[model samples]
Target chain A: MIVSPTRRRLLIGSAATAAAALLGGCDALVDNQHVARVLEGAEALNKDLQRALLSDTTLAREYTEADMSPVFKANGTQHPEGDAYASLLDNGFADWRLTVDGKVDRPLSLSLAELKQLPARTQITRHDCVEGWSAIGKWTGVQLGTVLKTAGLNTDARYAVFHCADKYENTADGQYYESIDLVDAFHPQTILAYTMNDQNLPVAHGAPLRLRVERQLGYKHAKYIMRIEIVDSLKAIGRGRGGFWEDRGYEWYAGI
Target chain B: MFHPRSRSVGKPSSSDVAGATQKKLVFRHPLLVRLTHWMNVLCLFILLLSGLQIFNAHPSLYWGKYGADADPAFIDIRAYRDGNSIRGETRIGSLAIPTTGFLGASEYNGALSVRAFPSWLTIPSYRDLSTGRRWHFFFAWVFVLNGLAYVIYGIAAGHFRRKLVPNTNELAPSHLAHEIADHARLRFPKGDKARHYNTLQKLAYLSVIFVLLPLMVATGLTMSPAMDAAWPWLLDVFGGRQSARTIHFISATLIVGFVFVHVAMVLLSGVWNNLRSMVTGRYAIEVEKHP
Candidate 1:
């Protein structure tokens, strides 16, 4: 049997990927939540007390053209796989719907077309990845608040959960998911994005839809969003915690 | 004569035992460098990994959105169909991954559910961070002191003034282009001189020593609310705590990147020669005889 270099690369990549899947797949491998929870709480309290003390910060430091690193890689869900994903892929996600339901008095299921009709925001922001890389790109999207108001947010609703099709981990309990509070939900720049760098969001860029929450690190912006649930609490969600990644031993609130 | 600290374990005197086995990696790093580098590396890695978990909480970056806890949430905290904590839902608890198929899986946000880790353990030991912080804080003195000593020594020894400092010529376009082409072609300078860092390596080492390391230390110190109280302008330096964090990550990334390139270059140039010099400090070569 002959294996070309491209084929060899593919095989090696798949093997490594399989190894990762298996490790993450371990049902016995439970999510270590204790210290993670404490750290989250500590970080929350810490940042809360120190929230943007730079409120008076003058202009952000300017950088020379030579300062930007030679390369800035795209991160977080560069691609979404699966048949459900493919179907969404077929027609450019024209039929796709982002569901905003739960405690809201009015549950609205809006399509890509309907969301575009709402007020949109565009900003050139630097994405700081937790993996130690940063990239600056322009993202355009509808303010999540606009969507919530259009759907009629309930006074009781206190948190919003974003359901993504990408499974970071699989268990008998359920697939993965993530969540955040309404303050971010209503932030002026917070949006359910459909475009990146002025182009329709490519699949490599969480096409169809991706969340853009500027305040937090890159991971908070869950890509491949399939549903948005507005509820009064995080308890009902996976692990009675907030998100899928959180369920897997991540900080719940990664501000900045 | 070199200072007492500068008394390098250089060429051994004839009186010393030649048969003695080599000592381990120099604790020459001094108490400070050892503490700061180790502590910084530790704190940084935890911050990075756990920060990933936080990002997992919500992986987006918006213009005005600040993924904050101060504001209200969209989910209901009280309303429970089966028993999912609805509001802010203790977003902190979300970090625990449960072992599925074993017990009642906890609910996330609402409707969405996941397995929970056994209530007893956490992945990152809180003790490690606490100790690491202490070492980091106290050891910071060591790093700063060692750095100061090295700087003073470099200047007094004329090492920095002679070796590390790039001449104006180095910054010239033609010189830079020559350097790049030489690098691409792997046409390195010869002998023990080459064994040591080249102009590029010297610049990189000098930058890490003078620039990135100090920035990492300052930004890390800026993160402390206690420290910030005494020194608010620290925040101004990097824009804010978050910005400091971003800088910390960026600095560490650069350091790690430098390490990768440094190691690669060492291996590429001449592995044994490079390793032996750093280890034994006696690089073997025929010293050319001038007639």
Candidate 2:
């Protein structure tokens, strides 16, 4: 077909305009609560599928020291801003204690030294960030299962919520928290890592302690853990979404 | 009364009158194929846009097991401040290219912002990685399910064997060369020839359906840590999560290239006819006339 240049330009211009309008419409859809809820429904599907397909014994791919990244990037809160964390850092975390309470048979507060003494397990694993970068580091810590066993999880405990010291920037509550189901909480590879790359876990990488849930994204690995609360429901947690990032729209089940 | 060139062709039917070319309408696409094709169109459109939004979260690609800010990336899209101006730069190893007003940096909400991809290219047209992911995964499910249905229908119904798979003669180097020459000259097949997909078309469609699309899905799944645990072999197959991510990006780029060529071919061959075939399952082709 033969078309005049002017007519072709008009058609192209209208097409561009239409595309812009479509984009605007998409933005509106993004903000719509109903659409957001429907999209969030995939999280349950992914969680269920992964839970059904993977055995509890299935471990995340462990790497050799040679496979580790030369430099592991410190993401999110490098140094928490609080008098409690500041004093703990000043004393080399000597006074810092991780309290295991809430829906546990025995509530206990264990010091860093005590945590290190609770049968340490070391494994080199990759840390995948939600922003599409990865870093592999060797972590040494006691398995969460061991600690949960020591404290004795209550029969009704459906989830283990990790409350951290560092507050994510821009968040109204300023609390960094994450939660995982019983299957992941008791996973053999899931550990409370206090050492990274054969050294004391640097404050930049979440000093004192960090939860390393290997099967999930980095955000699920709560850092500078101050408390582990066993809970039947996450409705009372920060914004009731389970995690700090989750409250901000990140999927609670970040298996993907 | 017929032209000399038409004498050697097939016998003219009642539709051919006064030596004029005759047009025949055929049901080109099946109902299932048409439905799946349009669904894929929607899925791919949303997936690409949302995928770009997700990619913008960390605008870099790398190799091997792990990659982050400290690690060197093969492709890095970032912006740097230059006195009064901000410069968008795309760096590949030793080579650096200024890509202002586009990659690395672009205007968002009337102000120049640092982002890997421009706002217009991404879904929501904003920097919401969470929402972007939601859109991507939701549409991705639709895409995969639709693709699975199409493939099953194609195989069970002989669509792949009869329509997509090129014959031995078409596979010959000389025939392929002729088809390439014809395509280059914009000489599309006519009449009965147009009823079936050309050899080039068959190969392109087959590769996209069987190879590229599957590769995309596999690589995408490899990036998921949960999937990695459930199926450790995916990590071995892709060489690592980082490598899988890079492959996924490359495959998406190739798919985009295919879409461009596919659209161009449709426009060049016969826009309305191609559109009708896909949308309404009807196509018009000129009939070869004979004396």
Candidate 3:
């Protein structure tokens, strides 16, 4: 059957309108709180499945020096905007100390030189960002497990939360923070990286120290680390979502 | 002595008239196939939209071990302001092409918005990467589960062996040429011939089932850091995470292309009949009457 030009135009227009309505409906569905909760279930599933499949000791692939990217992009906060971090930066972080408290047998405070003195590990690994980019760099630091052991982690400490100096986007609740469970916290590759590419960690790339949870995405690897809080649960942390990006609706367990 | 080709010439049911051309209802798609087919349709639709939304977060693809803003990109979609007007451009390697209305920049909520793949094509229809990711991952699980069910059912029911795999004769050069010519002329099979999938159809279905879908899943897993730790071979298999991302995008685009062609073919060659068969598992085919 032949469709007249005007009739065809009307049909096309209606189809377009219907499609737009459908998309609008999808937006509504996405905005629904129940739907959001249902979708969030996948994150837990992913985490559980990944942990079940891979051993706690299974390391992320370590690349060679040649494999490292020529320029590693420093994303999120380049330089924390505050006099507190600025003064610390000015003094070369000599006075800066990483306080390891919360659910710990020994509430220890260690300086950068002291951290360096306590067994360091250097490894080259790929950093995968949530923005769909990757950069390979050599990281040198004391393993988080070593640090936790030195601080005497309590048996009830289930999660290790990293509090950073930088405030991402300079928002009220953007004090950059991240958390990882005991499985990642004790992983050999999980380190408080104090150096990148054999040099002291650049300010743009989280000066002083950064948490390198290699198995997780970049957001989980909180930079500009100032403190480590060992906790039994993430419920008391920033918005109770475990991390800054998590509070902003990003998945807490970003295994995928 | 009944000929194999003469199966359609057999006795007709009571509905057949003496003078009118004979028509028979053949049970084509089984229940499992129909169920899975529709489920897959929904899964794929959600996946594509949500995936595009995720891709818009970066709007570029790269290769090798590492890539970012500092590193060169293989494909980049960007928008720039041009004297009070905004222009969108897509760059592939060194070549840049203006793609204003459809990609890079497009109309969102009645205003020109800078985004890759436009608002209408995305799940949330806005620049929300978090929500997009939630949708993508949720539906990804659904797609994977649906695909696994389909494959298992296809294998157990002999669906692949009985229908999808083409015989040696159909694979012959002359037969392939003939089929290509027939397809070019928009000539579809008829009568008993239509009862089975044509060689091209078999190849297309098999490739999608075996090659494209598996590649999509594998490359997708490669992009995950935890998965990489679990299965480091995935990184080696796809070159690297960035390379895997590129491959994932390419595979998804191919799937989209496949959908368009598949839909057009269905519409072109007996849309209602095909639709009914898929829905109800009964297909109507015309049979020539013997004198």
Q: For each candidate, what's the DockQ?
A: 0.02, 0.60, 0.59
**CAPRI accuracy category, model 2:** medium
Q: Give the poorly placed runs of model 3, Cα more than 4 Å off.
A: A1-21, A169-171, B1-20
Candidate 1 residues lying further than 4 Å off, grouped into runs, are: A1-41, A52-72, A173-176, B1-218, B221-291
lDDT of 2 by residue, B1-291 (tens): 322222232444345776766665677788999999989988999999999999999999998889999888999899999888798999988899999899998998888889889998998788999999999999989999999999999999999999999989999999999999999999999877887899999999999999999999999999999999999999899889999999999999999999999999999997766876898787776665444
Off by over 4 Å in 2: A1-21, A170-172, B1-18, B289-291
Best model per lDDT: 2
Candidate number of the best DockQ = 2
- Best-to-worst ranking by lDDT: 2, 3, 1
- Encode model 1's per-residue lDDT on B107-187: one tens digit a residue: 333433332211111112121222222223333444566567666767776766666788787768897788889989987
Sorting all predicted structures by DockQ, with the top scorer first, yields 2, 3, 1
The A-chain TM-scores of all the candidates are 0.76, 0.92, 0.92
Question: How does model 2 fare in lDDT?
Answer: 0.90
Can you give the lDDT of residue B222 in candidate 3? Answer: 96
What lDDT would each prediction earn against the true structure? 0.56, 0.90, 0.89
